[model samples]
Target: MNGIEHYRRAEELMEQATATRTNKSGFEVCYVTNEEQERLTRLANVHALLALSAAQADATEFKRELYRANGEELPAAQSAKERAEAKTARNAALAAAFID
Candidate 1:
């Protein structure tokens, strides 16, 4: 597969890992080896790139919405990484059914 395709796949992996991190363990990330953490970080980066490329981002409030959707500020070091993981998760859930 090409680079963008790889990015899409990485985004999927990040989404899955985020779900497991949030739902099953109720932790952002914990108890993973260094290799696993590195992989997860890479996945988050790919998802952020995909999200930005696909996004219209038409409003000023979109920035705040991203944070709210993410559910927290996330750790300082992990902030960007976390936001990207959440970009397409919760807010998209809201946007899909939002009434105009």
Candidate 2:
């Protein structure tokens, strides 16, 4: 599956983890156990990471294509420091997005 597909799967898993369902008597109940919910959430996080990685790779390829099309030299690989900084920023943004 592609990045978007992984992302959609992750969303579905999260929804399943959090959604309430009606019991036999028609009262709303959380069907999932705490452990089950935690497991699902962890799986969803894995998928989200995969999606993010795929998106970054696609963006890099797109930039390379654009440079080639414009007859410009491709950009150099990111230095280790730059990569570390980017990772930190990405993690921070993700944490902010998930903040309650």
Candidate 3:
């Protein structure tokens, strides 16, 4: 799935985690268990990072395209696509590390 999809899934999980129900004494009780909360937190974080990475990559590409359109020289370092990909990969790796 795409980054946006991941984000949507994370949002759904967050909603699930925060869901509540009325208790016998009219007190609110969280619907999710502690383990479910932890898992949802981890997954939400990972998906959020992925979404951010995707946005960064999109912005980089847009900037590069603008530069090319303006007849400006590309950067001497890595290409926009390469840099974006590297950044996204690093973010994903970090998320994976957290899960592990």
Candidate topping TM-score = 2
Model 3 per-residue lDDT tens digits across residues 1-100: 6668878988987888788999999999997999999998888888888888888888888989999999997777988899999999999999999999
Q: Estimate each model's TM-score.
A: 0.29, 0.69, 0.67
lDDT of 1 by residue, 9-98 (tens): 777766555543554757565456667767887877876666565453434357667777989663345577787878868887888779
Rank all candidate structures by their TM-score, best first, as comma-separated numbers.
Answer: 2, 3, 1
**Overall local distance difference test of candidate 2:** 0.95
Model 1 clash pairs are none
For candidate 2, what is the total of clashing residue pairs?
Answer: 0
Tens-digit per-residue lDDT, 20-88, candidate 2: 989899999988999999999999999999999999999999999999999999977999999999999
Model 3 scores a TM of 0.67
RMSD of each: 19.6, 12.6, 14.4
Model 3 misplacement above 4 A:
77-100
Worst 10 residues of 2 by lDDT: 91-100
Worst 10 residues of 1 by lDDT: 52-61
- After best superposition, candidate 3 residue 43: deviation in angstroms? 0.9
> Model 3 scores what on Cα lDDT?
0.88
